[model samples]
Target chain A: MVITPQRNIVSRTWGTSVGKKSVIAVTGIVFLLYVIAHMIGNLKVFFGIETFDAYSQHLREIGEAIFGYEGVLWGIRAVLVGSVVLHMWAAFSLWYQAKKARPIGYQHRQRWEGSYAARTMRWGGVIIALFVIWHILDLTTGTVNPLGGDESAYLKLVASFDRWYVALFYILAVVALGLHIRHGLWSAIQTFGANSALKQNALKTFAFVVAAVITIGFAIVPLSVMTGLVR
Target chain B: MKLTLRIWRQASPEAKGKMQKYTLDDVEPDMSFLEMLDVLNEKLVLDDKDPVSFDHDCREGICGSCGMVINGNAHGPQKFTTTCQLHMRHFNDGDTIDIEPWRAKAFPVVKDLVVDRSAFDEIIKSGGYISVNTGSAPEAHAIPVDKVSADDAFDAATCIGCGACVAACPNGSSMLFTAAKVTHLGLLPQGQPERATRAINMLATQDELDFGGCTNVGACHEVCPKGIPLASIAQLNHDVLGATLTGARSD
Candidate 1:
């Protein structure tokens, strides 16, 4: 195809806007896959504190051992932190841009015709972001957790879930994460350019299943702890 | 039926525009929306007032020239129907309708409801076409395409390049529109030669126009005159990514 200078300028600028979605979609898929993996990992809690704590400790021991310190877990955490920041930044930027593009208000109220997954993405994203911060502070950093009262990771987890609010927050966050993942998964595939309707619908259905697994799998941990099944 | 319309009016590309109210009485319910506007324009012309400027050629809806925000929807409330095909019966007597041009920074208002949608043309120009051979027409049946694939491609090809998807998008995302075209040509046998580069360059053009990202709002599909599915957007994304990764360079 023949390319002109004016066309070049137009593509260079306009293409950048559409191009950002590609990055967002790619990174979102990475985060969602990580979520699925994390949910499966969290399922260790049901096997009892020994298995869960051992698994957590094992994760903590995996990168570079600095002066006899195994920095593997820290390295993984760093990578995860970077992914989280990138995902959130991309999401917020798109959100801000979308907000600016809309008219102040519709002359007549526009009814939303989108699916539940797409509709709640923004809200679900916000809740998940907040939950991540709380989760890291409570478990990873041991900063504000009630159960970390004695620095016993297993006991801390058990005690934390004992609280109705803490348990509820975790459950609620997982649900929100579920919604975010369900939409994000297929959307990421769309961004990646999956064109076949059969493939698209399959991805959508697969995303729903993943979301269900994450929601139920993560919930199992807290629910088990709350009900004394883990004890 | 009688209805009040707040139509956007602008004298030139540089002129600031706003919604100006006009009342049309005894409007036939069977009249197309644009026809109703035409009736209103005749009244304005008779009154020695400048008629509202818009674009239209083929009134049958294939041309995609007519598009306006009707009560906050592009191409009005009907699904898979263009503005010219929209009937006035959708509105009730005494209804106050707000009509405006398709809003997008890339699609600047040329005059009144007629915005310069040339940005789409530019995007397509960037890489939308196939580099087919120049020779006698090939037998249509020569390309042994799977019926399912052919059907899907045809559906994507139905997109008329009306800026409705962008206009209806909260982010002004043109993903659906762009994707429809890219997927339409990309899925076909004829499009294979330029497929990789086409996806890349076309996407580059899409972003350059200051269009917003697709958050999968599905509004584009909802407002699409041809009912272009959101799946095409996904297809576009997939093709772009594949193109970008494979380093498919077109000579």
Candidate 2:
């Protein structure tokens, strides 16, 4: 029952809601940048298998002169893993705190305002989490990918998306991700104190545009594969 | 005007409450919402029944004491109006108004339509003050403040410590209320010394309490009687960030 402030500044910040929201905002920006970069990389598939495969190889070969082979990729992987962990931790703790705050429900509750995206943030987050796990297994590990671990990266991607069901799942996950990003970006901006009265509309529009582009950008790869355009 | 009322009735904090319906006749449209309640209580007293209990003080809407969820809206259906100031005219003839207490774990029901809002006091007690020595009053222009900042600070200072923000929020967050206090002081030169400390301590106190985390749904400002802007919350975030980054703990 005795609650004392943590010794470290970081841990102390974690003890407050504002601190948790800051974590969510910062980590969200990291994910946002990663997704944009990922979408651009995925678009290389349109240039044929050589360009796509070479692009994949180039990612691993980044910082080769200084960090040695695969060192930069591993570094990026480490950062991404850290970001995901912090993001999920902050999100879950906030959700738990919110649930604990309202032990009783109103007999007649109404959400006349607030965006649909904001309302569904929790469930959208859950869907995205599940999707990320499935995505890593399918593409990164080649465990769930139909092409197995023997095929090239391009071939594995093509093999997986060539199936209608797999492509459908990817599309659905991407849609959920779009909704998450839409609300998360807006919320993050507000949390970081970047929003103002004059800039509110602009920020909202930017959120929608980013969400739409990322969703459609990611969706195109699987869709092209299924439609025989990438073959 | 005639109306039907479905008011939440709870005997104690642990009692299981439910909606008890009542029919009110000879209701006047010009009567304030609280006056209608008073009439209802008189009838209940005449019938030898326990009259409903609710909070009210300075019924002119200055004091934040009066608050209730009327027809699913905090402080009644009218925008930017307190329960006491809300008139029966807003309700149509024969309308059925559903009244409930402010629902939040931090503010438990003391009785029907009355909750213990001392959690707000704890948040204020944490840092909502200036450490000024008691002596002769200082000169009016001892410390000059800019017009904009002063105005903004004044706006934030209008917060009445009402729990309506928490009651209306889907998450039951007190961010708007806490943010108003933080911004009001943080903007002033006097509040500069403890700016970072105030942010950290007050936010920590809020976390320790049962109040929820803010998701920036922007519902709090809508239901707020004083129309406290969401910008105050943005200011709160700015201060908290600075405090955390600098490790500014008063202790």
Name the best candidate (by TM-score).
2
All candidates: DockQ: 0.38, 0.57
What are the per-residue Cα lDDT tens digits for candidate 2 across A1-231? 223546688787787898899999999999899999999999999998899899999998999999999999899889999998999899899999999999998988654447888888888888888889888899888899998776778999999898899999999999988988998998898888777655777988999999999999999999999889988
Candidate 1 has a DockQ of 0.38
lDDT, candidate 1, B1-251, per-residue tens: 98998988888888866779999887999999989988999999999999988888899999888898888888888888999999988889999999988888788888888988888998889777887679999998998998877988999888888889988886777888788888889888888888877877776666656776778878888898888888887777677666555555555
Against the true structure, candidate 1 reaches a TM-score of: 0.86
True contacts kept of each: 0.50, 0.64
Clashes of 1: 20
- Candidate 2, residue A61: Cα displacement in angstroms equals 2.0
Tell me the TM-score of each prediction against the true structure: 0.86, 0.94
Model 2 residue B190 lDDT? 95
Residue A144 error for model 1, in Å?
0.7
Candidate 2 residue A135 C-alpha distance from true site, Å: 1.3
